[model samples]
Target: MKQIGNVYLIAAISIVGGGLFGFDISSMSAIISGDSYLCYFQQGPLNADGSCSGPHADVQGGITASMAGGSWLAALISGLLSDRFGRKKAIMIGSVIWVIGCIIVSASQDIAMLIVGRVINGFCVGICSAQVPVYISEIAPPTKRGRLVGAQQWAITWGILIMFYISYGCSYIKGPAAFRIPWALQMIPAILLFFGMMFLPESPRWLAAHDRWEECERVLILVHGKGDPDSPWVAREFREIKEWCEIERQAKAVTYLSLLSPKMINRTHIGLFTQIWSQLTGMNVMMYYITYVFTMAGLTGNTLLVSSSIQYVINVVMTVPALLYVDRIGRRPTLLVGAALMAIWLFANAGILATYGTNPGPGGVDGIPEASVSVTGAPSKAVIACSYLFVASYAPTWGPVSWIYPPELYPNHVRGKAVALATSGNWAFNFALGYFVPPAFVNIRWETYIIFGVFCVAMFFHVFFIFPETAGKPLEEVMEMFEDPNGIPYLGTPAWKTKNYYSATARMEHGEGLEKKMSMEASPERHEVVGAKEQV
Candidate 1:
């Protein structure tokens, strides 16, 4: 089969796997606000007041969270599948599963059926979400790595925006069609990705690990060297990957537990924290429950939908700058700045809600209110702006960085498992938040923002203190930097003081090979041992 060699095309297509995630996020946001959807899920007659009677708060929260629960489990197991079957194949499998899930969801008749379908789709999200970045990171050159991997975030934003609008438009239709149409529409990207991945090359590093050296070299040549066999870039990268493969071949088997080894644990923490903190930033609340937030802010009907849709546009638009400049700006600064800005927005929004909002029932843990807090006038508008600004702050920073950073943290041997573990942490928190945030709105009201705001502040310090920069560094160099005994510091002259360590080490090893070759020239085994050592 003819393979796509352009990094951009591969990123664009493989990233379609994450599209369902975007769809699920904003689709539910858009669908749940519809009277038809509420009526359908309620499975009963409308209230005598002509209001749609939705499912109970707990049942609704479970329905909303079921997908994340499924995603968490799928992401946990995805690494083994990717390692055994290859990243591209793993993603292809995910695409097919997503299509099935979409079909089931579109036809769901009750809350249980809907939850089952969403959970199935969540499995697809988990598998694809874990591996797409792994695949892209392996194929992309170090300099372009950020842009390509960041494209995952950009694509997700696009999915969210497109699906949200589709659901918004479908909202006008009578009955369950309002929700079913959008669910059915989501299958397109998955089907495209299923067929699209057929034409995309598998990860070169994966090929190298399996000892398919020729295919690996060809991939490196085609993707990075512009088809030039003699290109210095390809020659250098191939050498590094080949060496890593050789090293890994002799290493012990890697498992999830292996990620906690002394050499790997710090990176595990970094990767895990990188993903965890992103969810803790409260971006998903704005995304998954935007309509709820807007509803509480006193906006209704088209005005609420329009207001919600604009944020999706902002999400898509804001991601572009990060997609272009993340490598240039470096990872550490983007994370720190993003966290700080998100903190400001969350804090400001929380304060505004606490001061301007009115609570009628003030529900407790056992007795949750139907509506937590309601605001009207300028304060509600200000609260809405804060939500938009929070998303704007997040889109360029944590949104892209979280997806890219974890895959960059480990060597090929453990990269799949480690990335999966990190992603599992992400989905775990995602599921927890998705499951609880709805009830939280009733129980605590404005305090939710306060928790996330503090998390943003804490994450800022964490990034500054412990998180090392990974942007533009070759995987081997990142590996060595973490393995260094003295350690890279955040406060005291940090993140690998030596530049070009990977290349320099490669040269030193090459020079040693030459000296050994010269010494072997006098030995009887010269013809056998040192004959083709320098060929690559």
Candidate 2:
């Protein structure tokens, strides 16, 4: 049977894995504030307002974080599986795991069971999150890589928005169905992803890594050349893949330690931190606990839920511009500007809540187990606005760039493992923050925003000085830039310039060293693609 080779269509379907991430975020966030979930789980002490508060902060945090914890563990191994089995198969495996997890969550009768379900669900998320971007990056052309990979983040935002509304509608349900129904519905996408993957081809780069050159070229032609074997763009891209594969074949097989090598260490650090800092940006914190943030701001019930929904809508909308233009806007400017904007909003939120928040005690508005400091009037609106602006800034910049940046940094040999490591960094901090925020809300209250605000500030300088500009450069030249003797590895070019803008034919015509006869129009039958300086 013929598999789907349209890159855009593949990206759209494969990103269901990303949508599962959105589902997980809103599944818990949307309902945690609702009484049905809190009372059914017996989280903390039940209140007259159906809101509970106190002693189970840790338990509540644990339950909320179990999925993250499971993702953390699953992400660690996802790379190995992706490498050994193939990207398509790895995604399918994660989908199966996701369905199982949702089933477990849907049926759970107690807290332990819920935790188990969430952890299982998290395991699926870990695998998908780590692999989805890697898979997309490998299949997509360099010029369009950012846009294709950004679809994963876009899918995630869509998932969050869709699931939040689903949970919000279910909020009126009288019993456990409020949360259970949403958790069960999570299965539908995972099942779709599992079957959808069956009709998609594996990554061309993955094929090359395993020495399947003909199939590799076919995939490249299919996805990049529109089935034209002699397409110039396809020819150039194929040769680059060939040359890079030849280089990677001589290197030691990738292991965790290989990432520490002098050549790879710079990219390893950069990739890992890019992901780590994404979590520290406090975006997920807002994602997981925005209801709490808005509650503290003064809205409750449908009012608060609808307010949070708008933020998710903003998240979905703001991401589109970046998705279309990131390659042209460049990764550095987006991250720099995004960090600056996020910092301003976080600080704004901190100031508003710090000055005006008051303890509302056990009443805690409505639908919550407990309430701490609360805000009302203009200050509450200001705090809510800050949350909206923060998501607006994050959705386009770090949200997509973080996932797009890391996977593109490495060659095929180490991409699976390296991206897995970097992604694991994301899951690790994501897990810690998941567990940390509930208590932070209790102990430090408004001050939590201050910490994230500080983090945003620190990351601005980090990206300014260290992160290399990768926009529009081919993967081969990116590796070459890192290996360039003139600059440090992480800082690929001496300056962030497009070093290889000329295509193979253009360079040949311009006499940039290659013989004119070595044109991209050379016979498609030639299988031995040699080095740039060598004869074809």
Candidate 3:
């Protein structure tokens, strides 16, 4: 019980890295659409009384895309760095980077300075996003792995929720400080994450892979039980880990190139496409631009901020069910159901917008006509309802599942690299979406949700056809599922329906029943029993 308690504690702390990632996102999202932020960055003509106009669409897109571009570069390198220095150390480095970025952004005097600071923060977000899941998945027990790693997503949602409200509160302030205060507050979590990781145990699998067998044994004992180095659970787990490491040692040297080999290619594809599909779900469009979305839905001022806050509240609340039930009910069903529902809501939103959304005439700003009125009535309420529903569907499914699935696919030897590549893909796609969304809203108006709805439909099929069920299987056993020739066809099948299915931990108690039965038939005891019966 104590050992398990430690695992939860460590997970809770380490996942604050994820919280920082969420905080950066909400910090920017909450501020970018505000009038003060617009006035500060806006570069064109002033209003009749010489008041500043809001920023142009292109500028908003650039500011948002700049961070994603930095994340893209950092995510590509973070894997190699983590693989060399270790996951915990990489996370600490990322936290420090985040703090530095907060200071830079808070102190910025111009758009150039703000963009630079955001890019620096993006680098930190990329590192934490890639490493936190890998570290948590490495240490968590198989039965509890889903929720443990899923905790990262839980933290991210909490961060987003807290920052949205904080940004809302700050909106009441008089000047540029409104945004700066929220940006500065981000340092609190980053500082805590950096200091907190100092006392946590290193990933046992990573230790064993590096020939630190003694430390690995110690950690395994500490995490899996209390002071029992020779416990059956610990011994079996250690042996299997050592066996897998030896297999890698005897094979051709593991490298970034090795990820392309036939043995690993499928796993790599799964990781890469899962992230691609996740971004295609269009969750970030709502997250990063919720205020803008609400505005388009006919809300303004505090009404816009309050409506956006409700969207995030639903996001945080709905994600709880997934954290609790993903391990119990499994990954595939939650994702499939979520994807389907998301498609429904997005299309519904697009249809409502097409029917009821006003088309701006000439001299409109950011897709809204200068003469537009606040939308009231059933249609506007329906759009709000569908927007919340989209978030509710996503928070549990794609939001958390995308972060959890990739690390489970690869063996320890290449887990870091594989996850890194996948995370980079996520950021790369994120960059494109961030760059595309502001203009997409400006040019396409109500049809923007249609594009995402189509992507969601494609994602639903992609997951159903290609994604395997990894629930309840140990990391080692999950590797075998991919290695087995017969396993590929059955990848999508649930564990309960599959014949000869057993999790790695369960195998310890049950043994190899079929193999043991075959061995007993050839034994002398069986032959003598048959001879005695014939003589009698």
Alpha-carbon runs more than 4 Å astray in model 1: 43-48, 362-370, 486-536
**What is candidate 1's TM-score against the reference?**
0.90
Residues 1-536, candidate 1: write the lDDT tens digits: 98889899989999888777998999998888688887777744555566765777677788888998999999989999999999999999999899899999999988889999999999999999999999999999776788899899988899999998898889889988888999999998998888999999889999988888999999988888778887656776787788778888887899998888776788899899998999999898779888778877787789989999999999999999998889877888899899999999999989998999888554421122445788889998899999999999999999999998999989999998899999998899998888888878877888988999999999999988788777767777677556645554312234434232123344344342335324644553343223223321
Colliding pairs, model 3: none
Q: Which stretches of candidate 3 lie over 4 Å from their true place?
A: 1-5, 47-51, 362-375, 486-536
Model 3 weakest 10-residue run by lDDT: 527-536
The number of clashing residue pairs in each candidate reads 0, 6, 0
TM-score of 3: 0.90
Winner by TM-score: 2
In the range 415-465, model 3's lDDT, one tens digit per residue, is 888898899898898889988887787777767889999999998887777
**Lowest lDDT 10-mer window, candidate 1?**
527-536
lDDT of 2 by residue, 82-188 (tens): 99999999999999999999999999989899899999999999999999999999998766788889889999999999999999999999989988999999999
TM-scores for every candidate against the unseen true structure: 0.90, 0.91, 0.90
Assess candidate 2 and give its TM-score to the true structure.
Answer: 0.91
Q: Judged by TM-score relative to the true structure, which candidate is superior, 1 or 2? A: 2
